[model samples]
Target: MNLLFLTFTFPLIGWLLLSFSRGKWSENLSALIGVGSVGLSALTTAFLIYQFNVNPPEGGVYTQVLWQWMSVDGFAPSFTLYLDGLSLTMLGVVTGVGFLIHLFASWYMRGEDGYSRFFSYTNLFITSMLFLVLGDNLLFLYFGWEGVGLCSYLLIGFYYSNRNNGNAALKAFIVTRIGDVFMAIGLFLLFQHLGTLNIQELMVLAPQKLVAGDTWLWWATLMLLGGAVGKSAQLPLQTWLADAMAGPTPVSALIHAATMVTAGVYLIARTHGLFLLTPEILELVGIVGAVTLVLAGFAALVQTDIKRILAYSTMSQIGYMFLALGVGAWDAAIFHLMTHAFFKALLFLASGAVIVACHHEQNIFKMGGLWKKLPLAYASFIVGGAALAALPFVTAGFYSKDEILWEAFASGHTGLLYAGLVGAFMTSLYTFRLIFIAFHGEAKTEAHAGHGISHWLPLGVLIVLSTFIGALISPPLAGVLPESFGHAGGEAKHSLELSSGLIAIAGIALAAVLFLGKRRFVSAVANSGPGKLLSAWWFAAWGFDWLYDKIFVQPYLLITRLLGNDPINSSIGLIPRLVRLGNSLMSRTETGNLRWYSASVAGGAVLLLALLLILN
Candidate 1:
């Protein structure tokens, strides 16, 4: 047996079991099934990774075809598994990080009202993401892509009783759907021109078949980028992720932190060949990434809610990955993705512990002096923050980001490099802002509870992985990618790395001074006119939500109210009204009156005879 399907199959089994077991089975058993399915999948995937390393596939690719999906008029795609370095990276991240998050959730959701439901949704989420990366063809990938979107809606709205959460979920679904439509159009165009939707074939033939500067290729790739933008929460499609904190913290860590938000990067990486066919769209990817990262970083700065800060942070980090992809630094992008998953998940999970300890209080300003009470979580957060800050050679983020910065510099994208540097500064400042406020001040609220192995273990593991995993994995990860990956710069590499490292350090130092040491400077800046305006703008996500409401939403609602019912729908109502009139007229003519009936028949006969006379 190929055994790849087992990754999704086991999780599907668990999700189904947990779905029905709610209120019918013991909580402990439910927890086991929920966690065990993903755990087993993780283990199996690890074995597969080991096997892949030991005997790498020929041409660094493997495909397992389950069956032919369609053959009408020779348009055939299949239920196939496209296993390669890229899919392998995603699989490891999804299964591995997902399993850990599930473990953490087992503790986090303990004694909650819908614990089983949470696990069921979480399991299904993992299954969907797996299918997304594992699929062999564009159509199959779209199935998984839509699957994750549905799962995001369900999980984000897991607390259906809360109206805000429900709204947030709906917002996510509707916004992402915009990108999905563009992607569908793109796929249709590609299939229409190329006559195939197979991933491998597209990768092999796209560059050759599609000439340079082809308008069709540019439009098609741009459309695909739309889908990536929506799913990954880049730029205009990014307004939903912060509100998505309406869901559980585990979901924040699992879906938003590690996997779902990175879907855009993965899509671009997987289809790099197609993107290469249109450098215009490729440059746009770089530009979008640069702008989004900076925007999200600004949004993260003034956030009061700890989870929302992480939410913004996730968006910003994915922006970095996008930047890397745009610069033709594919390996650098994936490296950052893996490292970001580890640290970001660690941050969110550790935040969960803080929330649980503080009686679910999420305001970092209200939290104070947790250094003693939540020592493990405190340390774990420090590790996550350090990695997030990319503290030189000590953390995984440093190496991953160093590669991107050098690549950006080498590719002559100095403006994007500058943007990356600025984004890094803001990332550090926001991260440490929460840290200093939450852990340094006197305790404003008491945290009396301390968690055991279930909480601390996952946090500890993620903390360790966040610091070391990227460096260890980068070498082999590079090999698995395309030939363009991991190219070394002559002498600029060292200088570039040093400059980026100092920029990161400077960001940390500035945060320490402003937030930790000198508070009055911050107050002075806040009172300034420009500062106030910028703060208000960034806090409102650059007012995209407000602009969208005015431009798109209000008009829609007004139109609906005016035309949604009765008179507006009278076009449809016309048929029934006309039918009633015809029935009434016929009935009136037939009202037990043979004279009226004979006159009507005579008129008809006269008309027929007149027509015959005219013809003769």
Candidate 2:
């Protein structure tokens, strides 16, 4: 309990050592440092959780103040750790799942260049995420937020030799920054009006100071939602996540599963109090989630690359979490976040194995009948996919996702409830579609699955967690978060769950019908005029990328090209240009020709004298 700081210290040290090693270290040494650091952090978190459960903290919260960060005229914020059920949950996910991802990366990235550098960035990402969750004040949280963003840029572009990878990293950084700036402004607004960035203080003061739907509260929450929208990869700002697949598979798992993408969901849940006061903004959160989930689900259905399919699935799952937040199912949101980490990470790591086994082929259509070759990966995908599709009773996703649907239904947000159901069907359909097409058809490529304790161990653990066992490990959010608003018991809840389960099963069956055999029917439809148009549209992620490219990227590039010479700087350069010209002319006049020099001096004197005479 007293050594809560150790959790952060371990990962921070790992990042530093790995970073300064300069890639000169042995791969084994790098693996040990990277995996060991997060392992220690995870161990520390587990111990802390044990202590917390044994003897709960006062007020269900504990604040560990390390130092006074700054003080000015009655404003003071400390580098403090806030321990509660929420942060504890997030801490467990970041360190626990993060450690697994790191362990698996050691196997996946073997013989790859910059192996040590990859771990360094991931280590820093974990450290920053820990601080983001545990920070007691908004300022401290924002510091960690920016740190995570920086580490993401580094890790996403880990293969900097590839221009596409660099561009993906840049896209992620820039898009998320747009949201971060909005969040920064929101923080400033809160501090300006409320006079403090302390989250606990703001929570208490905000209700006392502002009424429901207050203008100030509304704008501030909306701005914060902007940050959440971008970080979570929700609509309008979601184009970068698919492109982010340019990084290694382990990097994809870390970002999409336990760390970066989940940050926005955590942010909103952490700041739920602010949003509650702004009902419209709170509802808008649901609307955004609903829209993004449906859009992403459609997009995922058409994706061929194993990783991109998972990437879009990540976006869609995150939308579910956001919908939970928006509908005031705070506990449900965090619960789903935890379960999502388990299954999504499993899916990604398994995909990594499949990619490696299939000689780096990513298109699902390109690799087929791999279930026999890579039994572990096939089992991983089946289990993870079952959870992702929310298969009834046996899968973790069933429990968490059903809760969201019930909450939305009970909250009387019928529209969102319908959207969630539609997304669920799509999830089941595409998840199985990928599995059936890739694992069942005749082998299109030779594949020899890799073997090692590092690979099997992570997949094995995650496969278990993706089952009902994961759902049983509940988040300790009772006192930490507000009670969820939409709780319905008896037949209504059961019926909703039943319907959702049926919907999921129906989707899986439909997928088998379409893709299990020769894939002739699916192919025919895909090649048809309407189907082709729709497939192309959805394959392009509903043209958000294309639209953004045309509306934002291309126009911005055009402006940049137009200003390639830097017209403003060129205009500013004119003064120096004229001065240089005059100097050049004067220099020519002073060519050491004594007659020319004398004539110029005499002419200047005559002109001066004439001017003086005219003035007199």
Candidate 3:
């Protein structure tokens, strides 16, 4: 129990050592400190898990208050850590998957500039993510939330020599900041009405204070959903994620798999009680997820950049999680979150190896016939891709995603259920499309697979986890979250699972038909008029960036251009301008005209005398 705090401490110590070294340390030394710290954190988590299971805490909830912040009118939010089944599951994902990503990064970032600096940012990212999932109160959680945002900006722009990387970093920072503001407002609303930011206390108090669908409660939930949508890259806020791949492949894996993108799912699940009070907002959550999954799925189909396809896939998968959350399948949502961390991290790392092998060639159309050269990478992709496509009972994604779809169907959210089905098909199609095109076609470039132990070890481990073994490890959420309507639909559950599985298999078959040996048919269609239009549209992510430029960015640039001279400052300067004008006119009276001055004095004296006589 006492060791729970060590999870955060180890990562902090790593960041401090790497950061203070200022890139003076040797690569091996820097990697030791960086990877060792997260390794220690992962070890601590394992021990804590053992302790937690062997000796369960009272009510399966353990709260460790480190200290009080300040006292004011019955408001003293302490720096506390909360652990339960839900947090424990999230903790495992952050530290366990985080350690793997860090390990792989040490290999992936070899010979790169600012290697120590990269480790520093990644270590700090792990620390922030730990705090995000473990914090006991909303205030503490927000503290971690902002920290994760800052670390992402730093890591995404790690290759700052490129102007576009910096822009990508800044874009991610600003877009997520919009969501942070809404989350902050939501926290304030919760505190104002409930008088506490402690998550457990709020859960107990909210039902007592506000009835179902109370206006204040509804707005609070709505504000929280706004935060979730932005952070998770749903709908309008999703544009930053694809560009975010401008960073290192490890950063992409960290963001997409382990850290920044999953924060929203954790936030919503943590505050499930509040969302439950507002069914309308809850329904909106499902609707947002459904729309985002369908849109991102189509966009992924046409993306040629390997990393961008995975980026869109992350968005779509998270959309499924959100849809699960909206339909009241809390456990199912988190179950998929865990499984996703396993397979998605594997895909990114495997893609990183491929990218490095082909001399950093990222365009899928440019690479081919490397399956024999990079056997490990090819195998990694097959396992990870199968899991991603949720290929029936053999992969981790199948069990978790199947649970989500079944819950949606059982909950009577037929629209959401169908959306999940479509997303499943698209996921399989694009995943295999990348796999077949990149690994099986005519060779277009020379390749050398990464051979070091650091490079292959992480991939080997993640490849195993992406299989059915990973799916068997269910999170201990029996009492932590609301139970899904599991096993209630009887034979219908079997039918839905079988249908989703077959749909996924069909997508793979179609991808093979279209992308494999696709010199003629697919190319011909892509060149045709309507095909060109649709391909271009999907390639640009359905023109969200263009639409946003027209609606927001262009107008904003125009407004700034019009105000380039500081018109507000000029308007406020009017008072001083008028005063200066008066002073200029008054100065003329003192302009060395003695006769005029004497006449003015005589007029002033005569007026005073008349006033005095009238008063008398």
lDDT of 2 at 297: 96
lDDT of 2 by residue, 1-616 (tens): 7889999999899989998999999999999999999999999999999999999988889889899999999889999999999999999999999999999999999999999999999989999999999999999999999998898888889899999999999999999999999999999899988999999898999999999888988999999999888888998799889998999999999999999999999999998999989989999999999999999999999999999999999999999999999899999999999999999999999999999999899999999899999999999999999999999999999999999999998888999999999999999999999999999989999999889999999999999999999999989998778888666468989999999999999999999999998878889999899999999999999998778789988999999898888978899999999999999997777688889889989999999999999999
Per-candidate Cα lDDT values, in order, are 0.87, 0.94, 0.93
**Candidate 3 positional error at 366, Å:** 0.6
Over the stretch 452-529, how does candidate 1's per-residue lDDT look in tens digits?
Answer: 677778887898898866568743454455554437776778887888888888888888899885478998988899
Quality of model 3 by C-alpha lDDT: 0.93
C-alpha lDDT of residue 203 in model 2: 93
Could you tell me the TM-score of candidate 1? Answer: 0.92
lDDT of 3 by residue, 1-616 (tens): 9888899999999999999998999999999999999999999999888988999899998888888977899999888999999999999999999999999999999999999999999999999999899999998998899999999999889899999999999999999999989988999999999999999888899999999999999988888888888889997789999999999999999999988899999999999989888999999999898899999999999999999999999999999999999999999999999999999999999999999999999999899998999999999999999999999999999999999999999999999999999999999999999999999989999999888888989999999899999998979888888776765767889999999999999999999999898558889999999999999999999999899889999999998988887968888999999999999999988878889989999999999999999999
TM-score of each: 0.92, 0.97, 0.93
Q: Which ranges of candidate 2 are over 4 A from the true structure? A: 486-488, 561-571, 594-612
What's the residue-level lDDT of 392 in candidate 1? 90
Clashing pairs in 2: none
Q: Top model by lDDT, which number?
A: 2
